[model samples]
Structures are given as C-alpha cells and as structure tokens.
Target: MPIVDLGSIRGPEGPQGARGLPGLTAVPTDQGLADYIRAGKDSKTGQALDLAPLLDKPTILSNSRRVYTINNGPWGAALGAVRDGIRDARILVVSDSTGQGVGGSSMDSFPQRTSWPSFLAQLMDDLVVPTAHGLGIPKSNSSAQPYDTRWTLGAGWAAGATYVGFGGKQTNYVAAPGSGALVYNDPRVYANTYDIYYAVSNNATYGQLTAVATGGGTNTVQTGSQSVREIRKMTVVAGSASGNNVVQITNSGSAGNVTIVGIEPRLSSQKKVIVGNASVSGSTTSDWVAYHDNTVTNGWNAFSYMSAYQPDLVIIDLGINDAIPSAQASVETYTANIRQLITAAESAGASVVLKSMIPSVAARAAREAQYVAALDSLRYPFVDLFNRYGSYEKTSAEGWMADDVHGNDRIYQDEGRYMLQALIMSPMSLAAKSVTIPALPALPVEGWSERWRADQIPLTVGSDVRAFMSVARTALKPESTWTPPTLAIGDGGRKVVRFNGTTDGLSLAATRTQPHTVVVLGRLRAISTAANNGIVGAGQSAGSRSSLFVSTDGKLVINAGVSLTNPAAVPTTTQVFIGVFNGNNSVAGLTGADTAGAAGSEGATAMYVGRLGNTGMAQLDVEEIIIYPRGLSSAERTSLTAALAALAK
Candidate 1:
C-alpha cells in the first residue's frame, strides 16, 4: 500500500485527540455473497463454486429491481440436501410436460405417468424422508373417474370452470352461492390428505356444507377479506382407497369471488422428499418470470406456484422453449427473464440453479447456444444437461431419448440422480473436506510459499496440522484438541483447531527478514491477557518485536518495529487478519478496514503462532494462515482479502 503524503489534502488537524486514522471494529468485506454458480472451483477463493444453489455460500444475484442471496437453504450447506439429510429438501420442478412426467409408461395422462421430477426425487431418496408435504396438484390429476371423466360441474358454477379444469390457468371456477362442486370418483384410487388451496377477495366462505342427498362430507371454512389474493389451503377430504368422495366441494355459500388456486394431495405413503412438480411443459424463462409475483390463483396457465413450494434450491430447467425461437432478440429476452426468475427465487431466500434443456432438433440446438451462453454470462449456477449428457441424438443412441426433445425414463432418471451427484462431487463441496487453502489467491508479487490451513486438520484429538503447498513448511503441533468452531462457514464439515493457551503454539522454520505479508483466518478465544498474546509474531524473545498480537491491554496491536496501539482492534470472534511489514512502511488490516504506519526494523525474527515470544501463549481457534514473503501492493492485498472473505461457505 502507498504511504501517501496527505499534507496536500489535509485541512487542519482536528482538535488535539484526532490526528491518525480511527480504529474500526472488524468489518466484513462483502455482505456475505457467494462467487460461483457453475459446477467448479473459484480460481479466486480456491473454494467450491457450484452448478446448484449452495445455501451455505450465501452469495448474491442482483437485478434491476432487487438483490438476492443464492443460499441453498431450508435445505443445507450443499445441494441435494435431502440425500445429505440437511433438511427434507423441498424441490419444486418448474418445467413443462417433462416436469409433468409425460413420456414414461404409455403416452397417457398425469396419473399413470411418473414425472421427471419424480425420477429426481427417487434418486434423492425423498420417498423415505417423510415430511408433511407431498405433491398432487389438482390440475395434474384433472381426470376424476370413468377412465376419462373430468370433475362434474354442479349448478350455479360459471362456464369458466371448463377453462380451469382443462385449461390449467390461474382462472378458477367462480361459483355463486351454493354452486356446482368439484366431485370426484366413488373409489378414491389415490386417496390421501387432500387440500384445496384458494384465495377469495371480499369476504367469502367456501367448502363442503352438509352432505346433501348427493353424498359428500360436511366441512365448512370461512375466509377473510384480503386485498391480495393470499393463498389458503383447506383439507377438503381425507379418504381411503376403499371408495369415498375424493373431494366434493359444495361451496358453502360464497357470495364474493372465490378464486380456487388449486388442490394439492399429500400422500401418506410418499412423504419423504416433497416434490412439487408444477413445471409448465411448453414454457420458457419468459413464462416463469411472468410468475414472479403470481400466486396460485393468478399464475401461469400451468399447475405450478413459483415460490409457494418453499424450495431450498430452485433448479430452473429452461432453454428448450426459450431456445425454440430462432431470433437473437429471443436470447436477450430469455436472459432478462431468467434473471427475473432468479431474482424471484432468490428474493424468497431460496438459491437457484439453472439447468439447460434439450431443444431436440439439431438446428434448434444451435439457437440454444445463445441461451446457454446468456445464462453463463449471468453467472448463476447452471447445469448444462445437453452438454453433460451429450446431445439428444447421442442420448438416443444410448437409448435414453423418448423422442427428439424428451428423454426416456432411464435418461431422465440419470439426469435427476446426476444433479444431486454433481453437487456431491462438486469442487466446492469436496474442498471443504481437505486442503482448503490451496486455491486461495495469496501468491501475489511475493514468492512466499509457506501456507497452512487448520480446517483440513483431522478430527482426531491430538493430530498435528501441517502446511500444504509445500511439505517442508513448518507444521503446527497442537497441544490442544482438534475441534472446529460450529460457525466456521466455508470449511464445510471441517473445523478450526483450538489452542488451550497453555503450551499450545507453533513456530516458523526460519527467521523471517524485513518485508513480508501474513494473513490469518482465525479468532481469539480469550481477550484481556496481561501480556501480549502473539497471534503470529516474530522478532526477539520478548518486548514488542514486530507482531500481529493482542497487546497487554487486550488491543490487537500491530507493528513492524514500532507497535501501534488501538483498543478496538481486539478481535474476540472469527476474523481475517492481515499484516504487511517492510521496514518503515507497514500496514495492518483486520477484516476489510486497515491502518498503515511507519515500520521500524521489527518483524524480522522467527514467527510464532498462538504465542508471544516465550511468555504470552494465546487461546485461539485457527482456521487458516498464509505468509507471502513479499510486500503486497494495495490492489493485491484488497483482492486477496475479498477472496478470503468468500471462503465462508
């Protein structure tokens, strides 16, 4: 960093107490934003970047209207959280006919065919992780009985009921007082817990009244008058496979417009991985983006609620429909729309993963190129199934294609399983397992090579932490146990190693010279030590020396030869500490803020971590440490600090 002659810009020294930079409490560089979306490792942080939403990373994806955190949350630290048992993962499949599970079995309807999302659910083993949620949307299961009969409309029902049942649009049956009801078959074949979701504006009550001569259950519900179409779920029927009214809603005299959103059935036997397959088969990014603010009662002409499923990670599988248009204008529109959808999903605190779909016709695949490129440019987690599984023709060669556009059950199953598997084997996920500091961009102008990471330390109590990047580098022989703190973010399952402050310490192999940079990702266990607690310091066996340590008064004192004292610099929690020293020019930075000063000839001795010379041993939790043997420029230091911050997974 440059030592500027501020005499030119200086007005006058303010009063007697303030002349230098004021000490700042620890400041996080960014507002905790993740870096990658494609399945890979970020070159900057050397941490995993993913093609799925890693809720743990908590990155940002901002557009014109809002900014969003792509956290794979309500899920877990990684993708396919259900398989990992992080949470019973809620996956909302927002696709088209493929999402409807159409190509499987015979070319029949929604009931007989298993959805493509079901394949993914089966792969995630969601069937075994029972939760209170399940997916059987009314539109998907439109047919009632007699092999082909739709729900029979009763009296007082509007002609629009035809549009709702057959046409899966936001338009619902506007029933007048005591109107025709949606009656099911006698034998409720797939009987489970059925919930009728609706939104009534201007105070309306709807549900089954008394079981008249028609034979239906007697259950009524009163709704409030709300401005927005707030969704409501009423468990209309809970029947058995032994013949019952699947769900007969004899509207309980609703005076106002009772907009029926949709019906969802939760199968008791299949409550593991709650899969909401509301994918609009012939839709694109534009269609889904249009649903950003849309709810069930006023959504697309499909059986999907954009965010109501409460997914931890929204795997947006688009491109085929968007790519179908052969104009460049379509690609730009697609890019904007997809970002809006991502903004919507992220707005709900759900991480988003964009997956590319197959266009089928070889020529249409070319049009998809711009779409894929556009998604890539957006830098969201994008899974290129077309590229990953090879072309449709190739997949068909492997007998996984149902036709030109859709994949067979086998291939679809593979796609589902691989999505989670990709998350499992992603570089981001695996990096948390070991050698976490390898990819951090610490090697600037300094040829310094010594580096060590505490996160990779084996969980075994007494294991020693060694330096990677080079075997000959000094190892930290811990006198304390290996227990990483619960909140160490990016290290995944691994944790920080704690020092008990007694004999717990580590030393550099050789005494360092004048100019060097040191960065430590750690936290102080105890403050208010009488003697300086050396975090990583060098120079003789006593006195101040040149160090980055907690001073006798509990301040984070930084110096090259001349120590600067600031009480607030004391860090009690986790932080990234950076110190640069080169004779009369030294800079100390904690978190994002920094303070620079004149450096004396200190910091030119062997460095010791967790100890000040021989006296003040520190009680600390160490996550990572880096020593670059040269003075870093301001830009490199800033870049390095930002990269380190992204390490919080």
Candidate 2:
C-alpha cells in the first residue's frame, strides 16, 4: 500500500483516513511565517532585540516631534544620556545677557536686552488671567467715564441748554440732573487758550470741579454755587490750547461766577491706552509698553503707541520730569498722573506697579525729595528706588549716578533686580504660583433688589475655595472617597475650586421651586465621556432630573437631558464652561441658541454644583454659581452671557 501511487497510479483515497492528531501543522496563513520574522526580540535570551547603540542623533529640534536615544545625559555625557526609552526632542535656547545702558537709558535698554524674559516665557506653564489694574482711566474723549460729576445751577442749564462752545466747538457735559449749577469735570480742560481753575479736596487732586465766572469787570470764580476766588480779566487766545492749566482753587484768586459748563468727553481711539500688543496684534515680548504722557512732541495721543507684548503686569516709573518743575508743580498732579496710568493698566487686565523717580543730586534733590514723599504715599504697589540709592549726593562716588539725572550701570542693574524682587514679593505674584483665577464679571444688580434672591453663595471659604462643594472630601460612592480638587485663581483674578469630576462637588438647599433658573459657570474636563455626566443636577428621579452633563460623546447636555452640541465638543483645554436652565429651555457653554422643550423637571429639594450624587461626577472647575427664583428672559440671558464671557476672557 505504501509503494502504490507512482506516476499515474494514484488510487482513490480509500475512505478518507481519520485526521491523526493534526501533526506539526503547516501554517494555515502567510501571517504565521511573517509573525515570527516580525517578532523583534532576541531569539535565545527572549529580551527585546537591541539596536546597535545609536551613533548619532538630531542636533536640531523644532515644532515637529522626533524621538531619540540620547547619549551623554542632560549635561552632555554619553554615559549620562544612556537610557532605555527615547526622548521626544525639543530645542530650547537660553541666553545670559545682563542687559545694557544705565540710569534713564537703562529703563528702555534693560527690557530690550534682558534674558529673563526668555526664561519667563518658558516658565509660563498654566493659562492664567493676567493680573490687571482696575477699570481703565477715562480719557478726554473716551466713551467710558473714569470719573463723573455734575452740578446743575439752582434752576438748570440755560433751559434746554446742552453743551458749551469753546473756539466755535461744542464742549458737552457728561450728564445733568433736572435742576442745578452745570459744573464740568473734564480732565483734558486746558488753560493754553483760557485760564482754567478748579476746587481741590484735601490736596488729593482728583474729583476737582472747574470754576465758573459771571461779572465782567473782575469776575468772581466759583465752582458750582460756591464762590472760591476772582479772575482779574478773562483772557483768551481763541485758538486750541496745548495742555490744561489746572489751577488749585484753595490757592487761587477767583471768587466770581462765570458761565462755567462741564465739557463732555471725546471717545478714545479704541478704548485702550496701549496701542499694539498680543491682544491687539499678536506679539509676545516685553510685559508692558513704556510711555510718558503729554511730553514734548509726544502728545497724549502719542502715548497710545504699544509694543508686541500684552502686559499682565506693568511697572511705571514717572514723576522725575514733573517734579523738576517743582516751583510750578504740585504733588497732587504727580499722583493724579500715577492714578491715571494705574487705571489704564488695570482696564487692560494688567497688574499695576509704580517706581519712584531715581534720586537726583545737587539742588534738584530738594524738589525730588517732596516728589518721592508724595510717591510713597500712594496706596498702590510701589518700589522706591530713590531712597534705596541714598538721598542725594553730587559726586558719582557717593551716588548711583554719573550725572544728576541718569543712573550708572550698577544703578540700572540694581533697579532691574529690585523690579524683579518687587514683582516676586507682590501678593498677586505669590498667588500666581498655584493658579490665578480672575474676578467674575459682576451681574447687573440694578433690578436684583426687587427680585427675590434666594441664595447667591460663592462656595468659597476665604481665599481657598476647596469647600466650594457641599461635600468636602467625602466620597460620592459608599466605599471610594474622592480627593477634593484644590483651589485655583480663575479668570478675572478670583478664587475658584477645581472638581475632579469623580468625587468633587457641592450641594445647595432648594430655594426655588418651579419657574426657576440656575446658572453654573466653570471649566470642564471630558475624561470618561460616560452618559449622565453631571455638571449641575437636581431632581426627584433620574427621568425628571434637571441636570447639565457631558454626553457620552463629550458634548454638553443640559436642562433635563436636552443635548446642545453646537460647539461640537468642549475643548479639553480648560475654557469658559457655562450651563443655564430656565425651567423650560436650556443652554450649555457658548453653544447654539437655547434648546426649546421641557428639560427634565426636578423637585425643589436640593441642587448639586459640580457632581450630582455619586454616579454623575463632573470633571470641572467651578468659578461661580447662581440660582434665580424666576426664569430669565431672552434679553437677560443675553446680558448674562455677555457678562460671563467678559469675565472668562
């Protein structure tokens, strides 16, 4: 039987023989052989097949990523870099420039050449709201009024009088009540054409009212209805004035009533002082744009020139020039300019820092001394470089200056160090180490007094908002406790709590029943896009639960499960996350318009802030929370949206 089929003698397989124990099997597919060849491993040792140590690696790196087994470790030692895993290569250039120039030139030179900026650019890890100064200072023509004051005559402005004409141009007033003396408070008022005078309070300078005169021969200068002094002969050139001649009423010689009227302000070029910057044009360099207001040839308008850097912190060193004219100058004016700059900086979302003028030698010190004193009295973050360099000495050996005005090289270096130190020592900078939350945009409390405000809890304890949630560190589930997220400084420079989405959350008492609206503002992280991920939830049962959640697809679902995925998906990069529910409709984040239809209704029992109960743990960062008894109208919603957007930005 074994020798049978030779050539054409193949016999029909006699009853297919039983398959015997599938002997050493031939690979059924080509993959069998390919797999063995592709198994990159040492055949005998079973260890990963090692490639000959890489002889060379890329010396340059860029935005495109590349992997390499580095030799000569971090410090460039072959032995040090001998590691197992490959490193994602990147190029980082460090500079050690000490900066240039000295004295007055140093201010401009130091920023241009200093390498610290590069370092700072690298260390700016987390996204934080740049510290800003208060609201911007109003300019002569700004739409916004930094300061406003109105005094109507006992009767009113010439019946239907609206504005006053100076040099054929109408000078308008900001606002006027029904009846009172029309007094002006425009800061841009100038005496170049006509002498200008105003009343001062406690020598503080700001909030002064311009004077009015009536009698022809020797008119009495009066602010509002009160007489202050007398103007000898009303004189005018009938042309445009260069700068305002601000006169202090207490020291003036006017007590007559002149037809004085408040001048309305002109609008700012674009409502900001710094012209070009990252926010305006997209350049990232210096933190601030240095400027001097109304200098020779450098008009007030010229002060608007901006650099590429959008400053989060601005340090202004002024007063030296102003004090030089001490005989004709006042400390009040110096401080007024300082405040204006501060307000402008704050308006731009930059923290304000002021530096006193460097000390001067010889007779100039007498005038600068008073300026220094006044500068120190200001209630702001101040750095006194004057006193630090000693009072005043004529010789370069005794002072930090070669001349009476400019500082020497060492002086400049010291100033730069002090500036850095001042920033490092600031409370804002200190808090910046962890997280910096900006202030929340304030809601219009105008009609809030009438509406029944049940509860407006901030959920923050002092500066630490870790207790923002109802449940502190307790676990949502029975066995697993959650690690409460830490507090972070949020947009608008305010305290906020971070929710791990797993166990971090807050529960509030039910203050509103039906026809109520709840608003939650925070940053969300979409980790596990499981269904029913709670952002804000409260209800009797799952079906009727009023909750805002991230759907399984990472889209924002709000108001009883009504999903609004217009934004496509919330970015993982923590951004402004807003959720709103108005009993009937709901909106999530900055998505499509409100979704019509009833969201699941919840009983007026309790409200969950971040996570609802245990199952719907929301990975979030809560910046603010609000619950209104009544549903908000479309207009109100729009307003709220605008306000919240401003804060988040």
Candidate 3:
C-alpha cells in the first residue's frame, strides 16, 4: 500500500497565510547597525567623543568697509580707478603742512598743485562716472583774492561732486531780488553740485548776492562761467577777535532750499572747522566740537571733526610727537584720547584705521621704544608703519627723511601702500576660526589614602598590612637580660604575644582583638620591675589563683580569683592591660582612664570593652592561662584554634 502524501491528499486549500510582521529590516535606514554598535560601545566605555573638535575653526564677523590712506601729493593712475568707482575705495589724503612737511605752506602752492585731491578727482572722472564734488572758498566783495575754484570744479568735473569752500566773510548769493537769475556755478567748483559756504571773516555779517536773469525766464548759467549773482541785502560789522568766523549757506532761491551736502575744511583749526590733524590750537573754546558731539576731548577732537562730515572711513597716523620723552605724558594722554575717538567714530558709523607711529632715530632707541609701547597698547585695527618702513638705521639712506625724524613724501607714499595692505588683512576684515580645549584625564579614587601615608602613619588591610615589629623592638624591652617577646597568634583567631624573657619573675599578658581586623598598631612596653601581680580585664582586676579554676562545665571565672593580700603594701598602680580598636575604627578612645590599673581602677578583672560591647572578637593570653567564658563548644574551640593556626603563618 502506498503511503499517503500530505500535500497531494489535502482535502481543501488552507486559508491564505497571514502577512508576517516586519523585522529589524524595517528600522530607520539613516542609522544602520554599525551606528548602533558604536553608540553602545561609547556608552559602555564612558567615552564622550566631542564632535565639536572635528569642526572647522570659529569665525569672527564684521561689517566694516575698506579705507585707503593716500599720499599728500599725486596718486597717479591709481587715483583714477579709485575716483572712477572701479575700485570702491574711500580715499583720505592729508593736506595740512604738518602732513606734507611744508611748514604752513598753502595746499595749492605746494609745488604739486595737481595734488592728491586733484589726481583723485581726475581718477574719479576716468573711473567713476559720478565724481565727488569739490569745496570752494567763500566769496566776499571786500576780499578780491582768487577763490582757487579749480580744485572745486575739478572735483565736480571728475564726478558729480560737491565742494566745501571757506570764505573770508559771511556773504549770501541771491538770484536777483525777485527774479531767479543765472548763477554760473561750476560743478567743478564743488566736488558735487552741492557746496558748503564757509565764512572766515569775523567782522562780516550775513551778506547776500542777487542776480537778475538777463535773458529772463530763468536764464540758465553757463558751465565753468565766472558770472556772479548780485550780493543780497545785508550789513557788515567789523569785529576784532581770534575765532570770529561765521559760516552759513543759503539756497540759490529764497524759497529754494540750499542743501549743503558736505563740509570738510582743509585748514587745521580746532576752534573752527572739524578736520583730522596732529594737533589744534586756538584761544576760543568753541573752536572745537565733537564729531556727532560725542563729547570726548583729546587728540580725537581733531579726528572727530573729519568724521563728522559722515566720511565712510578714517585714517589715523600719529605717534611721532608721542615718541619724544618730553611728550611721553602727552603720548599717554593722546592714546587715551584717541581710543575714545575711535569708539566715537565707531558709534557714529565710520570704520577707523589707526596707523602705528613710524620709527625714528631722533632720540635713538628710547624714542622707538616709547612709540612701540604706545602702539602695542592700542586695541583698534592698526597698521605697523614702524616695522613696514624698515628701521631708521636701515632706511635712512633711502630717502627716509632728511630731517632724521619726520618721514619724507616718498616714505609717506610707501607707508600709504603698506596701510592699504594692512586694511585688507586686518582681523576686523577677516574671519577667525574657533579654538578647542582638550579634556583632562580622570583622577584616581585612592588618592586620599596616599595623602594619609605621607604624614608618617601607615594604614593597611589584608595583603597591604604594615608591620609594627620595628616599633616594638625600639620602644619596649623586658628588664636587663630579657629576651624580646615573641609575636604570635592566640586562641580564637585573635592576636597575642608570649614574653619568654626575664621579667623579674613577673608574667604579663597583652592581647589585641577587635571585631574589625586587629592591629598591633602602637608601641608596647613591659614594666617588669613593678611588684604588682595582677591582671585587668575591662577595667576590673582578677582575684587570687585559688579561685582561678574554671567550672566543671568549662565556664571561665571572670573575678573568681580576684583578691589583694596586703592591698595597701602592693603598689596600687600596675596592672595587666590590653588595647583594642574602638568601634569607629579609631585608637583615640584609649584615654588616661583606660590605662589599666592606675588609681581609681575598677579592679583587675573588670575588662573595659571600649564601650562597644562584645561585638569585638577577643584574644586572651597568659603565662599559659586558659580562658573559657562559657566553655567553648568542642567544634567552636577547634575552629578557633584553626583560625589561630592560620594567622600564625
């Protein structure tokens, strides 16, 4: 008979198999099994891997723009690029004789009439289609001196610039009483169409110039024409004063507004116009004003004046005078003053570049040190001109300066290039990466125990125990010709000792046994000369030998043989004693009262259990004395002896 095949003989088809539950394969794909393993290993090993250490350095952020310090003279071809806006650079050229070493010479006649500003204007015209305007001198009828409007017109022609001109007197130009006249105002006269009218005359009152349109109907003024509109109705009162300049400007029309966009005075007068300078001197207190009225008075007062015109950037080059020993105090004052000024400029929305003072051999090394110190103390972004221009000794022959102290025009120009490079590399304009500190190693847990051992005491347990045998040999000894006591184990696994040396025929037993590990920790002494034949247990003295026998049941008598014959004759002090560790594991509990058998002793048989009760395991030793508190059971006794045997090893 053929065996039935289960599948072939199936009576009916089984229901469709239920879908199996998804397994670990369904877990998030982003984290694979390897990641889980790594995380687990990290947790078990207690390793905190800092991902931050793997990141790139931190960056410092800044919003400051670039500033270029140009020479006092021509800027050449580069000026065109800057002016043309091809290079969006803010150029600052120092004009005062102090900057040019002209010794109070006028900027126009400095031999380089095509000065840096002129070159800059030309550059602006070539590069930037809309050139910055120039400022013009204020015109007054009394003063016929040429206004030198060329600088103004050049600046304007280079780009739509404005000119800020200073006048000898306060005079207003009007278009012609009622009719708006043609005022041939050259765009070149001002850097832009807007010009600031500055009055330098103290005696002049507000004077006006008017022009009636000759052609009528708002006659247009010719470009670069020197036509003048009539002076407006006003008066002049002569006044003799040091700071008597009154500067104000009105729009071309009575109703038309005169928007004086910018005013940067070329002269260095602290009491009057606000401009950057090495120093300013004037009798009138009002000559100086804080840029944006920051109210910080110092060397910055001069710098702040230039900043007030809303300059995009400022170039601060100082420290020459600061190097003088006579000017040391002044240098410090100047440093603090400049710092405040920098803060003010920053507050007033201008980026400042402080140029470190150049090195000089004027006073030799002392001067250089002072200047260097001042620069080092400054926190603002700065260029090290001293280091860049080579040392005084190194560059002296290369046209460094003829005066030996002040730098020449060429040096200034070279320094300007250095300053430009520094601006590009300054921390203010760069990003600084973040820094990381490594974690420290873990400390050992047993450090406290090591600290204790250094103090000269030894504490130990088990295999780490310290031997006190040396202490006993030096501090205690039997009487003359007495052999040292043999240290050995006692009954019940307790520590004990046998003194076999001569002791004046007197026998003493000392045992150390506590529930915790027993330690023969301190020095022990044997006083064999004492006439006392007594023993102390728990502060009580034992009686005589006749009563010392144990019970038939083997219970050892505590005070059984305690007796004192001729008690008065026997010295009442000496007694057998034993030391035990206190409950807290400290040996401090052994006060004078516990010094066994002294005066006021509670008899030799009264054992002082250290107030810790019988929780302490004990050891008893005698000159072959036996102790059976309750007659140890045969098994218990055997176990005790075995423990003692093990301890002896």
Candidate 4:
C-alpha cells in the first residue's frame, strides 16, 4: 500500500498547504547589517516584523557588550570626570607591541602614528576644556608633549630611553661623571615631580637628585633599588616649587651603569591626563602577570607596581601575543589570567577595560579567535573590535595592514577611532546616576508635561527619521527638507542627533498650542565661539525671536532675554532646557536657572531645534524634545528637572 507508485502519488498540490506562512521571504538585506543577523517571531497576523538582532560574528557572550556599563565603576568616573573638566585623570595601558602601535607581526623599532592608547588620550584631551589653571597634557603631540621619555644610557630595558646628560633625543651612552649630574630638561609641560624607571647595568651608582633649584639647595637620595635587570621606578619630588622643568639626577661614578629607562613627569598640583604606556613587543599575559619575567628578548617589562601608583583606568591589552601558536594559552587560562589582571586593577581603585585580540595571521587565526571569544567570561568593558573589524582577508585587501598581525597607519587610525567611539558611547548604567528619578507610573501622569511620548524611530544608525508621533499616535512632521536630526549614538547608547557646528541642520514643526512650553534634553558638544549657540527657536529673526541658547560667557538664555547666570550650572554639560512663551510674561528655565521677560510672541507659531535661522546654528547633541500646551507649574518644573537630570547623566 505504501509503495503504490509513490512518484505519481503527489495529489493535486493539496491547496498549496496554506502557503506555508509566507516562506520567510526575508532577503539578505533584511538581515539588518552584514555584521548582524535578524530573527522574527510569529504574530498570527500578516508577516511578523523584525523582532531581534543577533550578532553573527565572534563574541564571548551577548552579555559581554562592547562596553560593560554596569561594571564600569571607575571607568565611568574617569569618563565623567574627564567630560566634566576634572584635572587629574590618568590611564595606564599595559600591553604587548600592538599597544605600542608597532605594525607588523614582530615588534618594530619605531611607532605608528595611531595607537589606541594615543587615540584614547587624544579623545579624552579634547573634552577637557582648558581653563586658566589647567591645560590638558595629552599624549597626542609627542614631540610637543611626549609621554614616554626614555634614557639613552643603557641597553636592555633602557634601550627605548635616551641619556639626558645632553638635552634633546638622548644619543650619548655615558652617565654624569663623579658627583656630576645628568639633567633631563623636559621639553614637555611644566611638572613638579617625575617618575623615573631605570635599570642598573653594572655596579650601583644611583645617587642624589636635585632640580628644585639650580643651586643644589635641596637634594634627596634616590630610591636606588635595582634588580639584575628588572625595570624599577623611583618617584622624584621637587625640592622647591620654583625651578625650571629640569630634573637633575646624579649617580656615583659608575659610568653608564645606572640607566634611566623611562620618565613620566607630573605637573606640580596641576590637573592633566597622562596615559602611561608600558608595552613590550611580542609579550603575552603570562609575561605580564610574572613581575620581572617578560620574555627577556622582548625588552622592558611592561608591568607597573599598582600599590605605589594608580590610574583612573587600566586598559589591559593582552591575548594578541598569547594567541601565538607556539605560545597559545588555553582559553581557560587566558580567561583566568585576564580576571587576575582585572582584580589587580579594580583592587587598586581603577576601572578596567579589556581589549580583545585583533585578527592575526592565518596560522594563528583560529587561536586568536579563541583568545578573543574567551573574553566573554571577563564581564568588563570589552572592546570586541576584532569581530566588528572586517575579516583578515577582507582587511588585508583594504591595504590598511602592514602584516597579518598588525594594521598600518590608516587602518590603525580607523580602528582606534572605532574603538574610541565604542568606549565613549558605552551605556551609562541607571544605578550609577547621581539623581534617581522618582519612578514615574504608567503614562497619563498627574501632571503630564509631554504632549508626545515614545517617539522611537528605527534604531539603526543613518536611517532616516521622517516623523515623530504623539501619545495619540498622530504624527508631527518636520519641514519638507528637514526630518530627523543628524543621528548618532551618545554616551549610554542613547540615539541622538549631533550637529556638526558648521553645516548640519534639522528643524521641528511650528508649535501647535498657543501657550506652549518646549522642553529639550541635550548637551553641547563644545563651547561655541559664536556669541550664542542656538538650541531651540521660533519667530522670524534674532530681534523677534523666542529661543533658548548658550551665551558667549557660558550663560543659558531663554526667550525673555538672557537670564541671570546660574551659580550651580555648567552650560557645556547635559541639561533640561525649557522655554515658555506667553507674550510679556514668557519664561525660560534651564535646570535651576530661570529668567522671566517678554517673549517676541506667544503660541510659538514657528519653531526650530538645533538651529536658529542661519546665524545661530547649534553644534550640539539632542536626545529628546517635548512640548506642553502651557507653562509648567513650579512643582511640575521641579519634577521635570529631576526626571530630565536623571536622563542627562
């Protein structure tokens, strides 16, 4: 019965079998992005829309995000402090040759222009606004403000350094004779103290050091503790406050026996960001965890004694060399050792970020992949850059690489920028906010300030956002040529529209309500040189305008002329800006600052965001904009401030 002409047993197509639920008709383009794959769920209606995006590349676990927002305790402080103009933010990057930005599988003698650490330091330096008291000392301009100042005295770990006996790129190999001194006239920034890393070649000769004054008034005995070949650090404090930035180190006559390997100078009581790089070529995690046991041939030990010194952040860039086939570490061992490094850093009051191994040569690709994927267990701020970057072959074809193991200047620069954006845009954990918003209940609150809510557009970057919807699901369209602002991802993975200071533009529809209050949640990317940086505006021109802006001297202005400068405010940081228009009684509020004066007109017939005609184009990033039919009461303003402040962070 079963075998009765089965080939001819195909009945009349069986009514198409109900069409089999649309056959998953999603094309490759529907997969969202090439690096990410999409999955859909059944909804009993027509086709189910895209539900979730599953990463299609290598990563430890989905939980190990590009940045660990929650666990980034110290990192968040460092990030926030730097953004807030904190004076003393330091980062220590311990890594192998890749950390040094040396392209090629093997360590090179010179450095490429774009190392992740250098990029990190530069990006951080950009945010630190210069004040009368503080100037950001970055590792960016090396010749102008060098970070790694080595001695040219000895071989071994001191190879990278130059002897300061004669100022300039240390070329002389001789030490100061007798009680004479070798002075390091630091050509960089002015500093009060200096970190001196040295190795003793022969008999000990590390002696007194005096640079506080030219007259040898105050000289202290040096640390002088030296191992056979281990790199040791000695902190030299200024004897007095008013000498030049010259460090005079004296050693008993042992010729070039006492060699200064590295010099990191600290500004006397001044604030700056110094990224100390302690990286050796072709070193691994094992080499780091072991105190003085770095591969002898790989040069200086890139290890820092955390107990004596500390940094705001510690970026551990290992696993690249560990993935070498001959020296391949077990994934478990790699995971455990990485944890060990994290513990040491965190225990020292510093936040840690893990750099996943980059793509390696074909021979070590598989092992490198294992080392990268093993980071899922670390649960720290992980830079899963290897996967986000193109494949080895694809990258090699791009001409951004010198060898399979190292990317050239261009690729390294792009990678560094990519890595930097990942790190800076890390999601801010809710538990870490200084102000906790009194939890709001389901919508339609007692005093609803927002006429529109939940205006979530396509989460994809570069996707056009045509219209935003109100609570009633109706739409508010922008001008014909205008739509979504220049979309970008800001800190905390928040989708925002960033204005490019000079050219970018976007506008919102004119206000519909007569007595309207417009609220904007955003921050300026920088302090504009313009007299005023427009945020939101209405009316025809500057004279007859209802607007909110940042004044030249860092004042937040509302529709009714500039307000009294708030004592407890920073115009550059994120703020909840409110503008109320009601003719003469119109008012504007910025966090705690408020001003009451006459607005050009009421009802806000015309409106714009991140732009004010042509002259006041804003260079800022905006997260959300809400409008209410009328002015917010004092209590409502308080509640809104708390709610918006919580989001601002």
The estimated TM-scores of all candidates read: 0.46, 0.29, 0.31, 0.44
323-364, model 2: which lDDT tens digit per residue?
444442566665665555444343222344455655665556
The 10 consecutive residues of candidate 1 with the worst lDDT sum are 1-10
- Looking at candidate 4, what is the lDDT of residue 30? 18
Better of 2 and 3 by TM-score: 3
lDDT digits (tens) for residues 529-594 of candidate 3:
322222222322222221221122322222222321211111112112212222222111111112
**Sort order, lDDT high to low:** 1, 4, 2, 3
Residue 210 of model 3, lDDT score: 24
Give lDDT for model 1: 0.49
Which regions in candidate 4 have their CA more than 4 angstroms from the true location? Answer: 1-66, 70-72, 79-87, 104-113, 127-150, 154-193, 197-219, 224-248, 253-261, 291-304, 428-649
Give the Cα error of residue 254 in candidate 2, in Å: 54
* Ranked candidates (TM-score, high to low): 1, 4, 3, 2
For candidate 2, the 10 contiguous residues with the lowest summed lDDT are: 275-284
| TM-score for candidate 4 | 0.44
**Cα lDDT listed for each candidate:** 0.49, 0.35, 0.27, 0.49
> Candidate 4 residues 498-530, lDDT tens each?
776664454433554446677787888786765
